[model samples]
Target: DPRSRDENGLAPIVWKREKMIPYVPTPIVYGGYLFDWSDEGIVNCVDLKTGKDVWVKRLSEGGKYSGSLLCIDGKIYGVEEGGTVTVIEAGPEFKELGTADLGDASYSTPAVANGRLYLRTFSRLKCLPAKKS
Candidate 1:
């Protein structure tokens, strides 16, 4: 199993000239690109068919990022363990859109329903306005 940790530790499988490993969270595919993030605040975008990295970027103020990634209307959102949500544009190049502070630590992935965003933090659950597209 991917999560099993015992005699065998984590290892990176070679992909082209780079070492690649499965992300802790399921990656999302959009516009022929795959987007995923790591707990170390590193985000990567790879070509959906070639398994080749298009771009890799790290969020500022590095910290634990446990929340699963969310993609909506061409933007990808990654939540840090400290409750800060970072939004980035989904494409070949990396472009950080913005970030929001939920005011509490969050490990659960944010959800969307009926045009609103829902987030569960350590201390609270919040519903915020999400742009309709």
Candidate 2:
């Protein structure tokens, strides 16, 4: 178990696992699970209570992934360095929902606010219309 001592000198319990390479995106906690994307672009869903990986999926064949991840409405979004945005259903099975071309080089993370998605490339910013259908 990965435990850390708090400022009060009390131990804070943390779930532990081995051979996990932390990725750029912060782990997403929802419904008793911690979702993380490895530096190698592998998505792992771990049991929050046990720190055991429930499922793992690779987004691409060793693609250089640098962007952050976005999960909303039971879906996980991943953006790769090659300007590809992949939307996958969040679950034990990796189900690809769809993908879109970003059209340029991008390192900036995608942003979702007020149901709208904002993305930026090197010198251009694109606003995607968001309406629940």
Candidate 3:
């Protein structure tokens, strides 16, 4: 069901899926593509023009992914519930950049602002400095 509504109470159906994970999936639009993450921590690249899935990759294991995926500097960031952050290249090819241990547990979505990445764990909030030259 579309959620957008204007004065006329109508919304355009941009895309629809037959089956989706039972978790919050945030779709990031970048470079003419839509990047989506499943609840089980699978990353998928879809063509924004046609909504066709171009590729998919499993990002993490052992725990479900509850945080929304973040795309920065041509890389995808997925944080699992067990506090593992997996970074991968943003494209059809699955290229891993790095993985960092946040040392905590969380299910909240992450946010990127002012070039810094913010993550909320079960006990505290962590601020990761933006990549520097």
Candidate 4:
């Protein structure tokens, strides 16, 4: 698998220079999975150790994915260009929990503080409280 290689082996697998990822958003690693967002608006979940693709899901409308991923309480978040935030369960299966829109444009990652999620768009900012179980 792609995850069990040496440091030098990571170069060719972890990142494919030949392909165009197109986005600069940071990726998150947790629970043995690496969550990444591509400029094509695709959310990719890969095995952290082997670099194998566990699953892939398109976040929203295609293009302009600049939000970093956030994982909290076994859930993950992906923000799309049009301010639509997608919440998903953190697992090997592609399960989207929900989606909420904030504005017309969102290029930054959502922030979590004091159990609240802070989202920003080209025109506004919103804070959503964490849902109680």
- List the candidate 4 regions with Cα displacement exceeding 4 Å: 1-22, 60-63
lDDT of 3 by residue, 18-126 (tens): 6554367577777888788888877778887678888877764535887787888898787888888888888767677888888998887778899888988999899
Whole-model lDDT per candidate: 0.80, 0.74, 0.78, 0.76
Ordered from best to worst lDDT, the candidate numbers read 1, 3, 4, 2
State the lDDT of candidate 2 residue by residue for 23-131, as single tens digits. 5666677677777877677888888877888888887544656777777788877677767777777776667788788888777678889878887777788888654
lDDT of 2: 0.74
Query: Of 1 and 2, which scores higher on lDDT?
Result: 1
Could you list the CA RMSD of all candidates, in the order they appear? 7.1, 3.2, 3.9, 4.2
- TM-scores, all models, native as reference: 0.81, 0.81, 0.80, 0.77
Which whole-number lDDT from 0 to 100 does residue 102 have in model 1?
Answer: 90
Model 3 RMSD in Å is 3.9
Q: Which ranges of candidate 2 are over 4 A from the true structure?
A: 1-11, 60-62
**Where does candidate 3 have its weakest 10-residue lDDT segment?**
16-25
lDDT agreement of model 4 with the native? 0.76
Task: Compare the candidates by lDDT and give the number of the best one.
Answer: 1
Global fold similarity of model 1 (TM-score): 0.81
With a 3 Å backbone cut-off (N, CA, C), the pairs that clash in candidate 4 are 2-50, 3-49, 3-50
In candidate 4 the C-alpha lDDT for residue 43 amounts to: 77
